[model samples]
Target: MPTPGGYALVHDRTIVAERRTCRFSWVLVDSGNNINILYRDTMTQLGIEATHLQPTRMLFHDIVSGLSCSPVDRIRLDVLLGTNDHFRRGPIWFEVVDLSSPYHVLLGRPALAKFMAVPHYAYLKMKLPGPKGLITVVGDYKKSLECAKAGSKMAESLVVTEERRQSTGS
Candidate 1:
């Protein structure tokens, strides 16, 4: 098990784990390109086989409630430790917390509180310091940014030019 702030060197570059409960067995994702995971070939990769993994309420750290009481089945992931700020102590504990409806889980100021979160924007590469070990966040920023820019431009114009090119903002 890797310690906090420690990197799990795999192949050449360090690899972070991407764990999720799919419709089949639990999946463990590794490698950026040509991704590999611990799952049988015949699987949907979302919920359990035959049955769909519907959103269900589960107990997570209650930041506001302080103690664990209100358990929610929100898909949003809540970061416990590894936030930007840290005292003499090391990273903090993480829990699968949830929030009420309407407040979408986004990389806003609060969600991006962790110093590593912004890296996801550039490449979605965030170093998540878990209790057992540190997991690197692998993300692609350039591609997403370009896609978003194009989408917004299209939304604003709602018209395709002869060259299908967008006019530079004047």
Candidate 2:
């Protein structure tokens, strides 16, 4: 029998983001999501001060648990996609949230639409128009598998902990 959080392996697409003085990799491409999200830790790592963030009253929901989440703030940052020879750079508004995720940033449909990008989940690739030609971003299968494993482990641990709490009536 399949274990909890151990379903069929799903291909998770990732991309690289380049800014003026920093570069980040393993940014999750989530087509089902409506907005882009930046983890708080990633913001700190990028040396972005909290004062730079703009206040927001938007609330988002977790697709799995149906839990509502309020973002800490929002920020507009220039994100460069693709290589030097072929790339697209634009300002993206990201909702900064405090959450634990395998990826530092989650690019949703909004970002994809801004870039006019198309993603092929089966092939683990995304393509967009670039200055020179079409820029194709390939995903790392090994990294995807690793992330799946880590997520599964985390979910299993949560279930075990919940069961223990219930048994102890805590």
The numbered model that scores best in lDDT is: 2
lDDT of 2 by residue, 5-65 (tens): 2322233332223333466555777788898998898888777888889999889875326
User: What TM-score does structure 1 among the candidates reach?
Assistant: 0.27
Residue 156, candidate 1: Cα error in Å is 1.9
Query: What C-alpha lDDT does candidate 1 achieve relative to the native structure?
Result: 0.29
**Would you list the clashing residue pairs of candidate 2?**
none
Kindly provide the TM-score of model 2 when superposed on the true structure, using C-alpha atoms: 0.79
lDDT of 1 at 167: 58
How does model 2 fare in lDDT? 0.73
